[model samples]
Target: MLQHSAILGGGMGGMLAAFALAPHAEAVTVVEQDAFAGEPVPRRGAPQARHTHALVSGGARAMEALVPGVLAELAAAGAQHINLPGRYLGLASRGWFPRYAGRQFILGCSRELLESTLRGRLRELPNVTVLGRTEVVGLQGSPAGITGVRTGSAPLTAELVVDATGRRSRAPRWLTELGFPPVRESIVDPGIFYATRVFRAPVDAGPEFPAVTLQSSPRREPGVRRNGTLLPIEDGLWMITLSGGPGSRPGTDAEGFRAFAALLPHPVLAELIEAATPVGTPFGFRADANRRRHFERLRPCPNGFVALGDAYATFNPVYGHGMSAAALSALALRTEFERRRKPGTLRLQRAVAGAAANAWDMATGQDARYPGTAGPGPGRFDGIIDRLGDWISASSGRSRLVTDIRADIFALTAPPSRMRSPRVLWQAVRGGDNGPALPDPPFTAAERRVLGVRPR
Candidate 1:
């Protein structure tokens, strides 16, 4: 077991690292630059917490495994555990996805609630310590391996150090300062900006269930791709998120937000907003590019050091995969520690990085397709993959078999090879021959009554 380990940042990812490491080390310490109250309120440090976040199935299961009963705890605290496709309506550029039975689900809650739960859970771990209001100055050791970190007063030295300090992490320069070569970065900026508003979901809006989503195609006229989603979150609330890129972002005003929603490819989201009462002022943004550091590629990764979450990679918030990927990465870290008592950081780094593979690919793939996206574009080989992907999207709404496989892949629970299975390939070949996509969201009479929308 490690003598001691330090994790920089007390943000969501950092807290997760503390959980992952608590069992593997004698003691774990988390350092945060900001002060926060015990309540589940927005922190000055986590401004993005005001936005919408989806705790996808794979990550949800990982969290449950790590904390054992945390999901139940979250539900008791008002988090919405929603089944995929079954409990939500999805609209792609093609058409609406038919509500089908599926194993995957997403937990809909504000980012604040999730992070607050993590923070509270951290206090339960006897071996973990959180040093709030402490600023991290730099690394304590050389590029050979990090021994710990330097704070404002005393330098903290440990056997291992984890950097979970979100997108604004300074680890690259710190590592270079310690004699490592400059860390190279890969970026795919979709130039996307988004806004979110929480609404007191109308109790009269039918039984609390299935959320709604309307998305524009990246394949649309090479410019701004407007999209909107309305999810029923905890405490009878609907978190509506509208987003796009390469142009004017949706405004935060009540009228402005509703106006933006009405501009979506479908009027479903707009009508729903019109029916509900606004709870708070709308919040906006998520412009950070889908950026990643290929630390795994660094031959002989520093022995006592690694990065997780946004420090390792930060995907566009629109995909809502960041929190889930971070949870999975912590799980990977624990798995590595279990297999070997004294594991090398290089392989361990690879394991942590692997957890993010599915999310990274999905976010980068979608972002690249948008017009005016920065960094890399889809390559020539990707052209074939895009066609296959489009085929899957079009068929997913109709074919249960296809939809299940697609969800598995999307939820990061299955490998990409699942799509290449004989059944899937056959479905792809059959294409739209199966028939028309769901022309309208498959809502029941009760749901239709609540949303006050007629069938298209």
Candidate 2:
């Protein structure tokens, strides 16, 4: 077991990492720059928390494994465990999805609630220390490998240092200062801005109201692609997020937010938001770029340091995979530590890095098609993959077997490559589901009554 370990960042990823490392280490320290409030509220450090965040199945399971019973805590806090495909009116690029039923699900709640729940659960662990309101300035060891971290007052030495500092991570610069080579990185920016508003859910909207998702097709004509997602969060409120690139970026005004939603691939999101009474002012966020730091590719990756979560990779939030990927990486950290019974092992870093591979592919593959996407475009083989993805998305709505597999891939329970498998490819080729595409939002009669959506 490790003598001691330090996690830099007290966000969900950092806290989850501490949970993972706790059983394998004598003591765990989670350092963060912001002091969390006693109640579940968004912190100044996590601006993205104001927007809607989804806890996909992959992430939910990982979070449960590391911090048991937290799901019940979230539910008790008013978060809805909305089933995926089953309780979702998802509009894909090809067509609307027929509500599917299976094992996959996501937690619909504010990021602050998720973080607060984690913070609460973490308090129960006596061996863990949450050092908040402290800034991490730099690294303390040589490039040979990190030995400790430098904070504002004193350096905290640990057998292992994990950087979960998020997208703004300074690990690369800190390593360079330690005499290491520059860390290579890849970024794909869709120039998209997200605008979100909380609505007082329709009076009759029950706890089981299906989540609504509108997806944009990036493979079409080169122009602004718009998308929207509305889900039932805590407090009997619905959080609606509308997204668009460049000129089409969602506006700050309430009218513009609804307009953006209306302009999406479909009008269901727009219609619902139009009828629901808004609880608060509309807000916006723009740091949704997908960035990846090639830490694993670093020769003999720093012996005592590791990076996970947004520090290692970030995805377009619209894809709703960031938290899940982070949780998976944390789970990987625990698995590695238990197996090796040590810190900073080569296997650990690689495992953590590999955990984000599927999310990276899914984010970049879709974002690269945007007209003004920053950096390089998709690989030559991406076109083929896109075609296969479209077929799967279209067929899943009609085929239960195909739908189950597709749902797993999106939920992160299954690798995206599974869709490319020979058997899956054969299924796609032969067309698994046989039926006409859904022509409109597939809302059940009960759901229609709740949302005031008129039946066809």
Candidate 3:
């Protein structure tokens, strides 16, 4: 039986892991390197927090069920609730997609605020302890089993160690230190880079603005690379992110960013930021890749430990799969923990890693669609998936059949198989007119002035 659990990070995955274990273990401690204080400010500890982060409805439900009152707390703290299909306006390589009502929704807020709220609730649990300012440097025990984690400042022993250390995790090295071979790994990197800036909202169109995205059209005659997004976060602010991968890179300067946004398929991103009050300098981040460790395939796995979130797999942040995958992983952990209550069982460890397979496949599978996506080429089935995704994107603008397929895909509620349904096939073949090409988003007259678009 597991008497205690030690989590080796304080990010979303780490925090969720603590929550999952708190109910099963006699005690749970989260060893975090940074101190959580002040009004949820960004820290160097979480680089992605500085970028735009949102919770899909699937993740939101999982988190709310794991950490009580999370949704209420987030809403009270200024997170915007957005209906997924009905409220989102996106420009894809094919064309603009018509917004349709769907069963799922998304919550938009700064990553810091979401973490701080969850941290606060978690700290209140009697069996959980937040070991603030504590850095975990290594693992304790042999490859047969992990007894505990050895930290930089202080070494603590526990029955189980959970690594939720995000992308820069030392788990692999630590495993190697214990005599285990390198975990089976896969990498599909598009070599994406990001430049983002926060601006005060020019208009009170919070709910109406509809999170706008202009996606890259790589499958076109001449492959192209570029994408832009405008997300409405907390405090009457909007976060605009411009990204390019491989040979394409967004500029670091403010004027350059604005100019780049202006060139995207739609003028929404540039228009939204043109006249808005700039609140912060543009932040840049690179090395965003899709990598995964297939721990489930190992013949003999270490006991008393498992890696989740970015530590286990990292998706290209451009797709916004990080948090959703983390939530799914946490649920997987809970399922495995419930299956085998024994703490130091290698069987249980293997099972936990096995549970993350679906999420890992989902993230890397689609990231492979980008042109010049550097990595191993996909198998025949993967090629079909990519082409079908493009087909659905082209047909979704007009056909309700494609709309259902799209809603299922984007909502993260269904597997890729949803696109193959006979209903979708019939509609794609018969409904030749996939509706008229979508127009520019419903921007107010003021928004037109901001982008300097002449009256049409």
Candidate 4:
């Protein structure tokens, strides 16, 4: 059994890994380059923190299981819980999803708040230590196994190491330096860009204000896609993010940002913010690709090391799956450690990868459908799956059952294969009565009154 564990990066994945390993190791250290001393604030390392982030039900459950009462703590911190379909104002590729009571839900908040809360909780663990402003320069040991990590000239020895340094992880380079063959990689870039700004919540807007999303449809236009979301975050602020794929990228300037929101399928997002006071200048981010490092496929893999979070894979943040996926990975790590009397590094690494598989497929599969998407295109089997997904999407806007299934998948509570079940398959094949497409935003009288707007 491992006596010491070191996790690189103090982000969600790394901190959670520390929690997972604390029970099995005598000492667990998280090496982060940022100081966690102030009120929850955005870190330079996580630029996209300013954008809208969703904590799906599956991830929320996993986190609650790990830390116990974390969800309640998050709620106390002003994170909003939005029930899927029931309280959401969403326009999907197919049509506006009908507002109905939902079984699944998502937590809406700034990334900074979520990470800070988690960090605070982690600090309470007696055996877990977070080393801030410490950069991991390299890994220690050979290609066969890692013994520790190198921080500049100093070496922190540990029996196990986890790489959660996100997209900037240098694990491949470090492994190559140790004479290991390069790991294969898969990348899919839809060239998605995001522009976000914060606005004071309108006077009438309340905690019950539904989160709004205008989803882009790849099937509608190959290279041109634009979407927007307005999430009510803490402190009576609405975080609005406008996004586009390739040809329709949003700009960083204020005017351009507003223009992008206006270009979405509906003008509700733009109109909502038209008279509202801006809290800050518009910020822009570019997530160039969804990249996966095939570490699980490595033969004779290193014995004492594994990669987690964005170190293993990064998805287009538009899907809002990253944080949740990290939580699931942490849960997987805990499970493997508990199940095995003596968990091998390779076995644990594979288990972590398995935890991330569903999210990877969900994000990349949809991104590949867009035109100008780089990297390997969908395979023959993937093409078949795409057709089925298209059918579901088109039908979901009309059929409540299909909509529920899609919502479940989006919340990460159900696998994509659930749609292939006999009942759902029969529904898909027989085609239910899909009501007419919504002509305008489906805001209720109360919601409209809160926004100070009338029904279109």
Candidate 5:
């Protein structure tokens, strides 16, 4: 029997869900409320799309497989490709992270470009149909099972309903309406605020000029909290953002934005902005914190229903892991669809959630280090691991091994256990041979000159 699938939301998750299920589902429909023009225009559904987002190698791989020529299309459309450590300069709680030979890379582009491309390509899939300007009001099913979704003035029936409606998902409410209890949820809000400005690229250094990042140090500057990042996107444009957490917050005004970046652990962002020509007004976004819904643990999940992407979980955007996590979640669902031809299978749900759990635990566990981070605080074990992670990344300025392990974790390609490998743990505990320490992220001589910083 052919099964019809209804996907709520049409962003990355919704589109990916449609891509994953289209092969198995008899018909795939994506219900999106925002107007989509088959081109990347700002939408109300994804406010955070204005900030810096990276398509990590792990997620990139999944996206490529799901939609052939996606990477090529993005590259053709002006996506910047960066390799970890090599093309990424990072600051940790300790100090500068050493640039190492990278195995994987990240695609840096506008959220608009990413979504536009994904939506455009998915439209070509014969089995996938996008229902724009439509909202999912509720679910049509019982507490034990989901049968379909209820849109305004329309009851769309489907054998399976996948909720990819992002952080604002009404799945819990819809389920409750169907006589089911609320799904258990966890939230950790460090009160993060982001302000981003786009500027014409300072210079064309190709890949030599890496992505610049000044990470927030939770323990070092106890009372002061500020961080900034400068990412090169397509065309000659740079997406610069200043982020503040907990007590500290980035400003909405342009002058204050530069001042905020200037006060970061480094002045690179401030310097760069001062030299580059601003393209437009700065964009800002603020959300409570990292939150995830535990739909897997529910006693009964309908056979034909599944949840993917932000609908299942959302992490702090500061980490830049949300896209990667969504890609991985989509892959899990795709893998299940390939193996199991039927919907509502417990094994499939468990497998997909279990796969998603790794990304959730790593993101939330590390974020818990913040003083007032929302979810569970780090216990003794978590604390130990956190300290070790800090030590390795901090000391990575001197050790290549530490840099490699750190890059792998950041890219979402390697599990958290990679850091605890006997090989890495041994050197981590003993502190390996020291090399030329990078006091701070190295900016090219030209970049420094452009930013008005004297070359080192």
Candidate 6:
């Protein structure tokens, strides 16, 4: 049994890992490279914090379980809980998704606010301590078992160690130096670029305002593909993000950003923000590849060591699955630890990897089909799955049953297999009476009035 544990990184994943291990270990220490002891501001370590972030329902439930009342706390701090299918004015690959009162929802807020809230809650644990400004240099033991970690010339011995250091993790090099074979990695890059800007919401805009999205279709050809989203965040502010794949990369400049928004399938996003006040210059990010480290496949897996979060796998941020996947992995770790009499490190690591599998498939499966995507394309089986997925996506726009099932799958509330069930499959085959697709975004009059924008 492990008595002491150390987790690298202090973001949402690492903090949640600490929360999961706190009950089992006598001491849980988090080694973070950046100083996060102050207010909710963008840190150098997390540059992506400036962009938009959402906590899907699955992640919200895991977070609430890990730190009871976290969702309520976030809501109190101005995070908006927009119900899925009901409060979302979404444009799918086929057409607009109808608004129906649904059970699933997601939390919208700035990444900085989300991290700061988790960090604050973790601080209340008696046995947990976050060592900000500390960096982990290497491992202390051989490939057989990691006994501790090194911080420059200093060393902190631990019974267990977790790597939650995001995509830039050095675990591969550390494992190699420790005489372990290199872990296999899979990278699928779609050349997706994001240009994000924050705008002051209209005075009437509030929590009741529906979130809007215009998505690009991978099935379309002979044209640049792009997508846009407008989410209402804290303090009556709208965080708008424009994404382009390959040839249609969105620009970082203000003019280019506006142009990209204008070019989306619908002009609602641009029209809504035309008169709104810009918070700052638009920012751009391009490291949106889906990368996975196959640690579970390694032979003679090292004991007392495991990788979680982006260290294990990183998905495209456009899907908004990263944080939720991390939280789910943390929950898996906690469950394995509590259930087993003597939790083997390899077993726990595999469980964590299993938690990330569905998300990895959901993200990479979609990105691999986009034009100009690099890395090993999908296999024959994957190609078949992709085709089915495309059919489902197109059918979802027309069928409420398909849309609800998709919402559940995407929110991580249910397994992907649910879509393959007989009832859903039959629905997809028979197809429901969806009527004509909405010519414009299905924004309610009340929502339009709140945003101070007229219906198109």
RMSD to native for every prediction? 2.5, 2.3, 2.9, 2.3, 2.5, 2.2
Model 2: per-residue Cα lDDT over 1-456, one tens digit each: 888899999997898999999998899998899995557877877889888899999889999999999999899989998886888878766566667677899899989889988998888888998888999999988867788999987789998999999989999999988888888898899887889999877766777888998877764345667888898998889999888877788877888887777778777887788668888799988855899998887765788888999999989888899889999999999988777656455777789878998889877877887777887977898778777777766554466666667678888888777877776666666666657557788887777765544322
Off by over 4 Å in 1: 220-222, 395-397, 431-435, 452-456
lDDT of 4 at 298: 77
lDDT digits (tens) for residues 1-456 of candidate 1: 999999999987798888888999999999999874567887888888877888889889988878888899899988997888799788865777767678898898878888788778888899998888899989977756788899987789999889898999998888878888877789998888889999876666654567888777765444668878888888889899998777757878888898888888888888888778888799887669989998877644677888999999999888778888888998999999999997788877888789998889888887777767898778988878777777766654477777777677767897666776888878766774346677788888777776753223
lDDT of 4 by residue, 225-338 (tens): 788988888777889988888788887888998888888888788888774568889988897588889887776688788999899988888888888888899899999989
TM-score of 1: 0.95
lDDT of 6: 0.83
Clashing pairs in 4: none
lDDT of each: 0.82, 0.83, 0.75, 0.82, 0.78, 0.83
Q: In model 6, where is the ten-residue run with the lowest total lDDT?
A: 447-456
| Model 2 pairs in collision | 86-100
Across 105-216, the per-residue lDDT of candidate 5 in tens digits comes to: 8898999999999988888889888899998898897876788888975889988788899988888777877887678888877677889988776554443467888877
- What value of lDDT does candidate 4 attain over all alpha carbons? 0.82
lDDT of 1 at 388: 75
TM-score of each: 0.95, 0.95, 0.92, 0.95, 0.94, 0.95
Q: How many backbone clashes does candidate 5 have?
A: 3
Query: For every model in order, what is the number of clashing pairs?
Result: 1, 1, 1, 0, 3, 0
User: Model 3's lDDT to the true fold?
Assistant: 0.75
Query: What value does the lDDT take at residue 341 in candidate 2?
Result: 53
Candidate 3 per-residue lDDT, tens place, 175-249, comes to 888888887788888888898888776654544556777877656434566888878877887788898877777
Q: Which window of 10 residues has the lowest lDDT sum in candidate 4?
A: 447-456
